[model samples]
Target: MAVRKLEHVGIMVKDLDQSIPFYTEVVGLKHQYTMTHTNGIIRLAFLAGADAQESQLELVEGYEGELAVEGRTHHTAFTVDDVEAEFARIKQLGVPLRDTEITTLPNGARYFFFYGPDGEFLEMFQPAPGR
Candidate 1:
């Protein structure tokens, strides 16, 4: 069977309250909804883009262990109008950045990496205009 589309990316976070603001305020995603498991062991918050068609970011709370190393590379990137402006905004927030400066590709795609409260890597990308 072929996959249709990516619905969302799940991230196990330590605290939903702390993580939720970052995606909503910094990443510019809207909080769609939140739910608690029947067992009360897990709580999830769903954040989505302004365009409903875009995939969402799910934040899962109640996990106790360290995030997997693979999680760092398994990052989710959000498209931005300007990578430089986003980078400057993140810098102003005093967030920890994986890259000291933004990087550009031959195709004119620009990006930079940063970490979340749980050390989860996140990227902001700007594709070449008119492409």
Candidate 2:
């Protein structure tokens, strides 16, 4: 048996229309598609980066529960080419940022945090060269 790769990360949201644009336009992901769950009460939207081989982000809406600051999922991170540039772009969008500035890890990786439309935690990660 083998696990090839992570399929996607599911994030609970309050609305699809708002979250879709945020993930697409703001986060730089493409809306692969949107569908309704078999239960008929829940709606789901799948998004991915320009590279289809990458894992996707599944946005679940219509769930009857509180979207706590700390939910079942901690946070969803996106791989970015330039952490500083992305941070500046997000800042210009007036999005609520969790980090005052980009952080550099011991391995030379960099990242920053921010909130989504539904108050979900999100991050932009840039790996060190050749990582």
Candidate 3:
């Protein structure tokens, strides 16, 4: 019918191995799979929520040198049903990531940040429905 759900978030990471734990431990998610499309062109890792589906995090590594620096972008925030646990877990990780200065959104959504090898804002927010 319509769109099933979010597929995955594509991130450009300087290193794949380094960002694994952040998604695994900090976010309390699992690495669904990893792949290399070419010898030194494209590499990726996919992460999914522990209790949910239809959405995943894609960590793309191996875009080295300056070719990967063209129009770089920022991190993304995934909506969650619970903010306390999400915010706490990310802070507990101690990963080098920046966010909206601090967690807690205007709509009472809570969030935090963590970098993926390269310094970028990876945000996670939990919002109450019917807001």
Candidate 4:
């Protein structure tokens, strides 16, 4: 089967109260809606950027401590026009970055990683021209 675009990235957060504001205000995402699972074991808050059709960021709750493996979940990357400017903005916001310098992948994509409110890894990428 052919894979379509990504639907959403599920992230487990300690508290939805704080995570919601961070994603909306800091990350510049729009809050769509929230809903709990049928079994009531988890609650999810879906968020989207200006383009609602793009992939979404799902803030998940009630599953803390269960998935604590680093590098396993890895990161979720968002495309940007200028990686440097975005890096500066994130720094100006007092967010800690994974590295002091941006790295260019073999495919010529520049990116940097940072930790989220719940210690999840997040990345910002800028692909090469014509990519």
Index of the highest-lDDT prediction: 2
How far in Å is the alpha carbon of 100 misplaced in model 3?
38
20 in model 1: Cα distance from truth in Å? 1.0
TM-score of each: 0.50, 0.53, 0.46, 0.51
Writing each residue's lDDT as its tens digit, candidate 4 over 15-112 gives 88999999899999999877765446777687999878787787878864465455324357677878888888898999988879887754465777
RMSD of each: 14.0, 13.5, 13.5, 13.1
lDDT of candidate 3 over 1-131, digit per residue (tens): 12223344667777888888887988788987777643447676778888655567778787653434654433465665655665556667776646534454344445566676665556665433563
Candidate 2 residue-wise lDDT, 1-131, digit = tens: 12234556778888999999999999999998787765578887878889867778879888776655777454577777788888989999999999998877554767787999998778787755875
Candidate 2 has which clashing residue pairs, if any?
none
Clashes of 4: 0
Candidate 1: global Cα-lDDT? 0.74
Model 1: residues >4 Å from true position, as ranges? 69-131
List the global CA lDDT of all models: 0.74, 0.78, 0.61, 0.74
* TM-score: the better of candidates 2 and 4: 2
Ranking by lDDT: 2, 1, 4, 3
- lDDT (0-100) at residue 121 of candidate 4? 76
